[model samples]
Target: MNIVVGITGGIAAYKAVGVIRAFVLLGHDVHVVATDAALRFVGRPTLEAISRNPVHTDLYEGVAQVRHVAIGQAADLIVVAPATASSIAKLAIGLADDLLGTTILASSAPVVVAPAMHTEMWVNAATAANVATLQSRGIRVVGPGTGQLTGSDAGVGRMVEPDEIVAAALAALRPRDLSGRRVLVTAGGTREPIDPVRYIGNRSSGRQGVAIAGAAALRGATVELIGANLEVSPPPGVRLTEVSSAAELAAAAATSAASADIIIMAAAVADYRPEITTQSKIKKETQGDRLRIDLVKNPDILAGLASTRHRGQVIVGFAAETEPDDSALLALGRSKIVRKGADYLVLNRVGWTEGFAVPDNRVLVIDLAGDIVMEASGSKLSVADRILDLLA
Candidate 1:
């Protein structure tokens, strides 16, 4: 695969080197293209040394070979990392003043952007509009996650990690691993209605499951994402089925898994629910000293999927255990994998410090055969890729 790495002006410009290294490690041919401002932060010599190709930073430097058109036409994927607000605006408006912009304009290949800027710039009406415009035209945007910025400010404008950006870029360029493959993935924490306005739910934010669906889609799989009331939106190119209760999730999973080649039970479905839901808000009665609500076990979606899995189909389950001893937790996960008849089980420790609702993650992929293919630690997207690689 021929990958073009486009670097724009931003403090995160240095991170683009990691993205290029990931692709190179994966055995893909890589070339670097930098904007004038990007050069200021990351030297041309450094990029050329890493990419093993001449850095292209000029629109007119190589006019005889029409370098911009040539490079763009040869690219399998165009990734713009540390995509500053300025560059995004330029791309949104079809500007071609430099090599990067001109090459982007000429490329027919899939494009992925990793935006990095201040919180205010990201939330600015112009930037938001530009992002919307780009998405409407089928361009992919990875992240500018919420975290500490260059200075005292802290918000959503921090650039996503290089590994994550690389994963998204690879997903864009690779043969859809799920192409012609039907996959059903459950996402988010299921809500067990207790009353008109309240419900029992877990701490799941659904980021991992959404990443799984997005990764699968990139691999050419037809994905049905059975989502609960998630805080975030599902990635583009997925069929989303919304559900609230555990029962609803189970029903959706069952129906979707009927024709699926792979079924991943990633949702943090509630283990129990109230025996009954009140039509109206329950008042705090002054007459009563205390009150209690009876609870009942909810249907086990993972167990059901495992039990009914077709002969050739693959069923993957997830176990989020909070245990002090990592070895014991892994052992328990292995037992669950066998008991549930799942082909693979992803085990991760969840607590106040790590796992659950966080951008980064660490996981162990234990197969039914008791073999560990990957013991990786990184972003959720990287973890998803490791799982997919094992499946492949």
Candidate 2:
């Protein structure tokens, strides 16, 4: 993919370096086009070094090649990170006063804009009107998240993280099959507390669940992610609810499921939790060599959702097995689908190296009747997209 990254003037412009590197690392040909003010924040040398291409900031830099119009015409996608209120107004009004503006005006490829500015500026009537105008013309806006900003002031105008911008850009290029739908996903291993300092938890990193939520959001679903101790940041554009125990996860899942069109039980929720939680930390020296703790069964979130789901709602469950053989795993998965009353279940072999903390996954999607609906092997994101495909 050929991607054009437009950087405008903002303190967040410095973060655009990561945005460029992210696209390049994803195997895309990246070109950085910055405004004069953007160059003041992130220099030409740095952008050139990361993108591995000559940075363009002037409309006349490559007149022989007609670079201004040519670059945009040939782009597969255009992403403007740290898009300032100034740049937003320029693009909104079809201004071509600068190279970045001219190139954007000429581009026919999908455009994704990530806005960053002070909270007041971002919410001003003029900026809001410009944003509405741009979106009315089919331009996609990523975010201006609320957090610490340039100085002592902070609110809704912080630029989202670079990986999120990349995710949004890629999402903009895909089909919007899940648009207008609400999706609920759970990820990470639930941690059950035994004491103030001691707890039981699984090795789940939440990569697969995050991937599914991301893919669903990219496909246009309004996603609510119930994450439990995730090893990674939740994907951009999803509402995140963080939890630490099975009970908390169960409550979150049950609450969000009421309005979700699709619900995925991808979290590695503990089947059991410590029967008793001590207020004080357990000490090794005081209770030398021996330890015992009772366990209690956790509510089956997936089964409960499946049983009470609306007639047209779809519920999916995930089964991680160490059954050691394909036949056994398949049998277990088939039985689980029926037992849980879920419309679909994803079954995967997991152990120390394969599923828990890894980036890729191998899985079989089994339907309620024990039929294999889809089998996939690749990065968790790919698996996520396939799951959505099946849902569609």
Candidate 3:
């Protein structure tokens, strides 16, 4: 794959080197285009040496071959890591003043930006609006996770890890394993509303589901993500159907799975919901020592989907267990796979060190035939891709 990496001006510009190295290590032919401001942070010689290709920083550097258009048009994927606020705004508005911008303008390949900026800049209405515009056009944004920034301040707007950016870029270029295939993916922990301001939910942060959806889309599948009340944003290009309660998720999953090629029930749906939602907030009363509420079982979305799946369609379910031993955990997954009638099941151990709300994960993919196809221990995206590879 021919990867074109763009580096813009930012304190995080140095991080793009690692991004380039990762792609190169994967045997990708990488070419780099750095903007003038980016050069101030990381010099052209360094990029040239690492990429093993002539680094293009000036739009006029190679006018003989119309280098900007040549580079862009030939790229399999364009990745702009450490994309600064200024660069983001420029790209959003179609600015072509520099090599990076010009190349992007001439390219037909997918463009992915890993943004890095101060919290204030990232949160500004202008930046937010620009990001929305780019996403609406199918441009991919990896991350600006909340963390320590360039300065003493600590908050959102820090760029994601370089390897993550590389993984996302590579995923974009890989064969669409799910192309034309309809996949129904459930995400987030369902929120059972108790009142207007209160709800029953879990600790699920939806990161795993989001990663699955993103990975599925990159494999060329048409994915319908049934998202519960989530704290994080869904990846770009997945069709999202937002729901707040377990009932809503069940309904959505049932409806969407009608035409789906695969159903992945990854959401942490609440087992029970309040029988009756109060019209207003339930206040603490003097006799609250014996307060009680009736609960009802929510619909079983995965079981329901597996029961009526079409011929050849696959059903994948997730099971998060708190078992202490590997044999017990595998046993739990085995039982769930049989009981749920799923074609495959992913067993994840959840606790302070394992799954749930974390970027990395360790999982076992168990099939209905009692075959363990793969045991993954890495980033969620890596696990998701491995699953897709088996399915593909």
Candidate 4:
């Protein structure tokens, strides 16, 4: 794959190196098209080193070979990582004053832009209009996610992380095998509330589940994501339902499962919840640090869905265990799959450091016959695609 990465003048331009590096590591032929201002923010040498290609900035430098247009013409995909407001305006109006602009204008490939700017500039009516116009012309906009910007100012207009940008860029080039398929995904760790201020929850950051949802959407699935206190945002094009407790997740999943062709229960649901949830915070002084709250088991959402699923629905369950022995882990996974009666069970060891909040994972897929169907180890996104391959 030939990918042209366009970097604009923005603080987030520094992060574009990660995007370029991700593409290079994915075995794509990467070329950097940086604006002069972008060179100032992120050094040309750095971009060249990461992309494994010389960075192109000047439109006039390549007039003889027609490099400006040729680069874009040869591109399978064009990505603008830190697309500043100024560049967005230029792109909206078809301005080709520089190499980045000319390359974008010359490309027939799918163009993806990850916008970066301050909240004020992003929310401005003119900027919004320009963005809308670009989208109207079929430009794929990744995100200007809400977060910290330059200085203390923060809101919408922060460039999203590099992995997300790379994921979106690559997804555009993948075959949409999941088109028209409805995928139901549950993410994060459900919190069982004991009081208004405190709850019992696992260490799930929702990276794996969120990655699955993102990958599913990228494969052109109509995705419904039920997230229980997710640490990350739902991928672009996914219908998101926010829930905090096991009961809420169960209810949401049950409601959404009927129409889904694939159901993946990835959320680390709490096995028990407080029998009585206090309206006010349970003070340490009043409780003497030894408050014993009665507990009750939450519903087995995966089992229920698997048991009652309509014909042809592929139901997948997840088990995050601390079992250290490999054989024991496989045994546990196999037994759990049989008990839950899910079509497949995904098993992974989650200790303090390896899983839960990490970006990478190692997992085994257990079939109903106690066979290991698939084993994956890599970044969550890659693993997610491997898991989806079963349904795909």
Candidate 5:
């Protein structure tokens, strides 16, 4: 998803950085269109670094490329954080005097604005009327919730929090295709303990799984997010269960899967565990660095779910492999699907630089019969929706 975050001048302009970061972390391409005054509060380099895209400010800088409109044309969503009184009035009347104004005018995407100004300014007749006009034009207004204002002031004109803004912005465009469905998702990498202070774990930050859970909630599904050592927070409005080891995850899944309409196993479960865990940390000096720990295979959670799933239930499994050959990757996926008994297997290649904790992912999904069913590559959230499209 391509997101354009418009930052206008205000004390709240600094808050837009959080909004930009939230979008970027969710695997969207964020392009910032900051008013010159907005740049006064937040630095251009900071915006560029967080957005991972160049900041576009000047209306004349890219006139040859018609860049003013191109940014909006490519946008899937536009969010204006700290929309000042002047900016709101300009937006209400469809002003194109600045790049942000022109971008909004050029795009057909939904517009979401979080207003921020002095309480008096926000409550003024002109500001209230401008807000009403924007809302009337199908614009989504998140909030100018009552809270702290600039120095020595507090009122209802503060910008809403970044997370709330992101949620509202995404919700404005989301379709509830999974309404009335129950979804169970397992995310993050499970950790198996070796001793009191030592443990074996994978580098799965649970990003991919978290995205699936968040996307499911956005689609109007009743979401149960069972996270295993999650490195990131799950989106709002989902039932969250935190677990650690593979056994813990298996237990939780068994208890939850019975009622779920769709079960997505995105957690990277450890295949093996220490057969005997020490009561205390193993001292390296005492062991002379020659200690060996026995291993035992963990239960196959996906297979168990597939075997016991009720009719009309769907089970999706993920396979993160390191094979470089495309043919080999697909072969591995085909074999895993058969072995796991999952309805669909999402196969992704992961290495030191790709997959795992990254925001984006590339996956090939195959069904029970080893037939390719879906191929998706993009931000994890986008990939997640494509996966959900299969069920929807």
Candidate 6:
């Protein structure tokens, strides 16, 4: 794959190094086009070293070869990370003042932009218009995530992580087989509050769920991510709703499932919660060493959605088990498929050192008769694609 990475002026330009490196490591031929202002944040030498190609900025450097236009001509994909408001405006209006601009204008390949700016600038009418215009022209836009900003300020204008940017770019290059579909994905471990300070929770990082949501969005689906205590940021280009408890998750799932063409239950929802939630922090001394608390079972969110799903709506459920033996794990997963009434059940072995918070996972996709439909193992993102393949 030939990838052209564009770095624009923004404090977040420094982060584009990771984006370039990610593509490079994936065996993609990467060419970087950085603005002069972007050089102020990340030096040309660093960008060149990581990309293993000379960084292009001057449109006059290779006039004989028509470098500006030629770079785009040979490119399979073009990505601009830390796309500043100025650069976005230039692209939106088809301005070609610089090498990056000219290259983008000359390209027929898919164009992906990762916008990073202060909240005020991002939400400004001009920027919004530019973004809207770009999207209208078939360009793909990633995040502008919500988080701590350059200084004391913070909002929904932070650049998403580099890996996520790469994921979005990859997705943009893929065929939109899932176009016009609505996908609802649940992620993270639900926390059942026992007190103001403490609660029962699992170790799920929500990476798999986030990956699934991102995959669906990349495949042209309208994605709604019902996240609970996520360790990772929600992928750019998906609707995210945050929840903390199983009850909240149930309600959120129920609501989103109403319009979903596909529902993936990837969250590690708690099976039980404290019967009585203490408003104040429980005192350790008063409770003593052997304190006992009443617990109650949580609602079966997946089963409820499965039972109510419209015909043709696909319901996928997850089974994360600790059983080391394959046969035992398969048995448990098979039972779950029947119990949940899901169209497909993904069963994975999870241990303290392996699954919960890790980036990689191995899963067996099972059907209602306890038969294995498919087996997959790889980065969560790859597994997500295979799962989506089942639907496709």
* Backbone N/Cα/C clashes per model: 6, 0, 5, 0, 0, 0
The candidate 6 region of ten consecutive residues with least summed lDDT is: 20-29
Best by TM-score: 5
- Per-residue lDDT value at 96 in model 1: 90
Better of 1 and 3 by lDDT: 1
Please, what are the lDDT tens digits per residue for candidate 4 over residues 258-291? 9999999999999999999989987889878587
Reference-based lDDT, each prediction = 0.87, 0.91, 0.86, 0.91, 0.94, 0.92
Q: Clashing residue pairs in candidate 2, if any?
A: none
Q: What is every candidate's alpha-carbon RMSD to the true fold?
A: 11.7, 5.2, 11.6, 7.4, 2.2, 7.0
**Clashing residue pairs found in predicted model 1:** 176-219, 176-220, 177-219, 178-220, 178-221, 179-220
Off by over 4 Å in 3: 1-36, 39-168
In terms of lDDT, model 2 sits at 0.91
Q: For model 3, where is the 10-residue window of minimal lDDT?
A: 20-29
lDDT by residue for model 1 over 1-392, one digit each (tens)? 68899999999999999888766654567999899999999999889888888899888887899897989999999999999999999999999988998899999999999999999999999999999999999888999899999979999999998878876877766666567988888889999988899899899988889888888888988889999988776776789999999999988888888899988888898889999999988877842877688999987778888888888999889989998697898789878888888888999899997888787789888888878867877777767777888775
lDDT of 2 by residue, 5-109 (tens): 999989999999999987775457899999999988989999999999999999898899999899999999999998999999999889999999889888999
Worst 10 residues of 2 by lDDT: 20-29
Cα deviation in Å at residue 270, candidate 1? Answer: 1.0
In model 2, the Cα lDDT at residue 107 comes to 90
TM-score winner between candidates 3 and 5: 5
TM-score, every prediction: 0.63, 0.73, 0.64, 0.70, 0.92, 0.70
**Best-matching candidate per lDDT:** 5
